[model samples]
Target: MKTKHYLTLADAEILMNRAVELSAQRSFNMSISIVDEAGALLLMKRMDGATPLTAHLSLEKAKCSAMSRRPSKFYEDIIRNGQMGFLTLESVTGMLEGGEPIMYEGQLIGAMGVSGAKAFEDAEIAQKAIHDFFQQIS
Candidate 1:
């Protein structure tokens, strides 16, 4: 059998809290989602005043990022460049900027997604949270 790493509940909580803290700092009511490498939802939160839709969108974004092992912006850029065919890819929805893969020890273990703000701002929260997480672990 082969070995694989996965995000624990504690790890997910740290990511969620960091993302929420970042969003709060920006005064942006946001939704955040964390997913394991297999695109399984690990934890999610929707800040007060954030739209309900943000919760669902954040989950999809997390799944996309975890499964694709790349920032959701990569797929969004492809569609923006007229590569509409990308939209037809199987199980590859949520092609937006807020989703980013989470890596540890040079391996992708999960992903994080943020919503209810500008696309770039959402991406910033996810990226910053992951950066802080890695710093803490290091």
Candidate 2:
């Protein structure tokens, strides 16, 4: 038998709260999404000024990171470097940046996606939130 780690609702809430705080500090209105390792949405939030499109795109970015076990930006970079075929793959979407996989103790537990700021800024918010979440928990 093998032991596996997964995210609970409490964990998701912590991540969300931290992300919201970070966004507020930066004066960014963001749409945030969290997803399990299987790319299923667990939690989502669209801030007051975020666009409706950001809500949907945020989830897709989380799905892409969760499903691929890599940052969504990975796909975007490959595509930009001439791997246009990545666009045809149906396993993932939201290949633009801003999605970050959540890993704990070398185990991939989930992912977080943020939108509304610049693409790299969105990615920074997610990455920083996840980093802070781990620090608080650890």
Best by TM-score: 2
What TM-score does candidate 2 get on C-alpha atoms? 0.94
Cα deviation of 127, candidate 2, in Å: 0.5
**Which parts of model 1 have CA positions greater than 4 angstroms off?**
1-3, 86-93
Computed on alpha carbons, the lDDT of every model, listed in order, comes to 0.89, 0.92
lDDT, candidate 1, 1-138, per-residue tens: 856778999999998999999899999999999999988999999999999989988888888899889999998898888877635544445888899999876778999989999999999999999999989978
How well is each residue in 35-57 modelled by candidate 2, as lDDT tens digits?
Answer: 99998999999999999989988
C-alpha TM-scores of all predictions:
0.92, 0.94
Clashing pairs in 1: none
